[model samples]
Every structure is written in structure tokens, then in C-alpha cells.
Target: MGLYHNRPHVQDIRRMKARGEKISMLFVTTPDEAAAAAAAGIHMLSIEGRFFDATMREAAGDCFVQVGLPYGGWGSFNGRPLATAEDYLRAAFHYAGIGGDAYYCAASYDIQKTLADNHIPVVGHIGLIPSYISWTGWRAVGKAADEALALWRHTQKLEEIGVFAAELEVVPDRIAAFLAQNSSLVMLGMGAGPHADAQYLFTEDVCGYGLNHKPRHGKVYRNLGPELARLQEARIEAFRAFKADVDGGTYPAPEHVVPVKDEEYEAFLKAAQG
Candidate 1:
């Protein structure tokens, strides 16, 4: 909201949701995709901090961007090694300063609160969180009564900590509905059900470029894989053609050869002789 005056932001998303707006969100990596998303009227974007450089932000136009903090593996898995909660606060503030609309962090409630304290709109993660996927065995959560209750309780804790939104991932429809209906938090559904305020998906999944077969949750709208394969084949053919041209001495045609003055050539010849 503050210096993000140049673009529509979290405040805008919140306002629209309060008025019962339905929105679509996507994970994007390119300015081209951002432009398309803006044109498509997508309300929210979950983008890596590196992906939302000046170009992508400009492409985003008025759309809100939730800058994703790292979620998994080696360094900063669940954001622990990245920094203390205070460190995330500073990082979040920096991103916000540069026009990030919100910050997505799967962290302890205390850590999430730290970001909110610094005026960074925090989007928390719940229900089959990826970083802790090993514990849940990489599957749906909130299906069991106790587990679902825990998720509900966690949602309450997140609300109490003043998170702006919560990403509900791979939870049962009934549980998602219950949480969305009960919680004041803006529920963004990713592999969750329709009750959520916004539907979210990764770019790779949406464009049909995801590894292996598409997940049951993903609706592969286009067969980018075949197109991509065709493109790759074309690229290989291009390189092969260029190789043939070079081998056949067909490259460096007269047009490609630089013109040199006779005097300059003579001078170079004389210098070499000397």
C-alpha cells in the first residue's frame, strides 16, 4: 500500500476479497508470463524473489505479487538457515520497498509475525506443507480428524498473528471450506478445493511442462511439452545447418565479410613483413 502506490497491492486483494471477489493466482518466472497474467486479469502471483526483478514487476503492472521465500532443501529449508525471524523481517521489508505486494513464508507463527510486524504482508502456508512433506509422506493432509483439527488450530494461530493470507495446499474440500468459511484469512487454494478465495498453480504445471505425468490436482490446459520438443528439434536442426554451412565453406559470405581499405591491407602486409 505505502510506496507500492504505483501498483495494485495486498490491500487491493484484501478489499476485493472482502467484497467477495474470485481470483486466479499463478507462479510465474518470466516477464512474458507476467504480461499475459496481467492481461488475463489474474489477481495474485507467487513468484520467487529473483524472478520478480524490475522487468517482471513492471510487467505485473497493478497485480499483487507474493514474493516467495525459499521453501525447501539444503540452504534455508523452511527459511531456517536464511536468517532469524528478524532477518526475514528485513528481507521482507526490502522486497516490499521494491514493490513486492506481499511475502510468502512457511515458517513458525512467531517468524510469520515478525514479518507482519515490519509491515510486510505475510502469506503463510498450511495443509501439506512441502518443506515438511517427509513427515506427511508427500500426500494430502487434514484428512484425519486430529490432523484436520490441528490444521484448523494452526489457522487460528495464523489469524491471531495477523497474517494477510494463508496458502491451503492439498487439503480435503470439506476442511478447506470450513477453514475458509471460519477464518478471516484470505485462503489461496493450491491443490485445495474451490472454497478458497483464489485458485493457485505453478507455471510449469499449468503450461504442461511439469515433470512426469501431471498431478491429479493440475489441469494441463496446453500441451507445451510437445511444442517444446518440437522447438528443441528445430534448434538442433538450426545448429546442424550452421555446422554444415561452416564445413562446406558456405559461411562468411561476402556480405558477412568486412570491407577493408586497400591502403589498410597494404599497411598490415608491410607491418608483417617488417
Candidate 2:
């Protein structure tokens, strides 16, 4: 593992919040994406545990990386599902050892607390957790007064559980602004507007290559989807041309084949005939 002492720690992120600095964060899966984010001087990166390792950490450079622990049944070890706090803790510790700066755990309070107690910086999720979308459906949260209050209470609960930050996703901008100003937890905003401590976006969304429906808050900075499609077409055409060359005996041209000495070929022919 490369030395990652220069990466931002939990206190550093909190200090950024205190200073009212707007942090840039991205959810990236590939090493190339991580390296690009690092090169661009992104403050934080959210990577899934499955995609995080020493290589990923190295690619992330000095950016604070939040390795996401897969929640509940989605998380596993040796074909067994992670169903308990210890299971989640093991996952978090594994990534932490790999140089992960923080962990994003949307698991139960017990799991979150376990990671935090072990000195693992934990980032919790609030306002439109996709995993629990069955209850709230796909929409902006904290619109109603009671719902907003519940969201505020949820943030407090996460803070009490020792979580250092929370993903404030798809909450009303006004509500999110109010909560960010009042809350101790650093808010990593997805759809939560300018008042957040950090603005988070998926790499695919920013690059405009995502296959899924784009969220209203996700801004496409570059439309690389068409370019990527063109590349795929080029790949197919190149393969087809190679196949056609082979079928038409145009591939094994004189220059493409190794030349043997005439005397050696004659000797081989004589031996074969004998």
C-alpha cells in the first residue's frame, strides 16, 4: 500500500465544514476514474467496498476515500451474507487496512456504532436512502414539516452514533441548507444545494455515460456517451475487418509471415518425403 498519510482525515473534513469551504466529492468505481478525480484535486471519493483495495487507494492518491460497506444481504463473506454488526465491522476494518480514510455504512445503528467505536470514520446516509426507497419511493425528502423534522432527528441520531458525515441526498434545498448550518455532521450533498459542506456526484453522471435514468440534480458536464458508443462501433468494425481479411486470405501476406531459408525448407521437404 502506498503511504496515504496526506489524505484528509475526519478532523480535516470537519475543519473544512467549520471554515465554510465547499468540498468536491465523487462516487467512482474504476481506478481511472479515481486517478482522474485525484488529478482534479477532488476532496473526497466514495467507492464501494467491492471496488476498493490497495490499488484503488493508490489511484485515489491523497483524496479522502469513503469505502462503502454493502448493506445487509448485499454484503457477504465467502458466500455468506453479512447479517450482523460484526460482519459489517469486519468489512469496514478490511477496507480501512487497505488505506480507506472513511466508511459509508447505511446499515443499522449497531453496525454504524461498531465501526465508529473501532475508530473507523463512518459516513451515514439520510434523506432518500435508495436501499429503503420502498418506504419513501423515488422523490425528494424533507418536503413536509414532519418529514423534515424526522430527517433532522435522523441526522442527530447518526451524530450520536459517532458518524462524522452523512449523505444528504434529494432533500429540499431550503431544508438541507438549514440542517447543514445547524448540524455537526458534515453534509455530503447529492441534490441538497449549495449550502452543503461537500457536493457529491457519480462519475458516470458527470461524464454523461450512465445507462440509468438521470436524476434532476445530476448535471452532465460532458456528454461522453455518444463518443463511447462510437468507440464501441469502431471496435466492432475493426474486428469484422480482421475476420474478413482472414477469410479472404489477405491476412497472411508475405510481410506478415516469417521467412525460412530456401535450403532449410528444401531439407525439411526431403525429410518429410523420406
In candidate 2, what are the lDDT values of residues 1-274, reduced to their tens digit? 5554788888999999999998999999999999999999999999988899888999999899998888766665546677788887788778878998888888888888988898889999999998898899999999999999999999989989899999999999999999899989999999998888899999999999999999999999999999999999999999999999999989979998899999999999999999
Shift in Å, residue 102, candidate 2: 0.6
Angstrom error of the Cα, residue 262, model 1: value is 1.2
- CA lDDT scores, all candidates in order: 0.82, 0.91
Candidate 1: how many backbone clashes?
0
TM-scores, one per candidate = 0.88, 0.88
Provide the lDDT at 20 for model 2. 94
What's model 2's lDDT at 181?
93
Candidate that scores best on lDDT: 2
Clashing pairs in 2: none
List candidate 2 stretches off by more than 4 Å: 2-4, 75-78, 243-274
Clashes of each: 0, 0
Q: For candidate 1, lDDT tens digit of each residue in 58-132?
A: 888767888887643423523355556866776677676667888888877788888887777889988988778
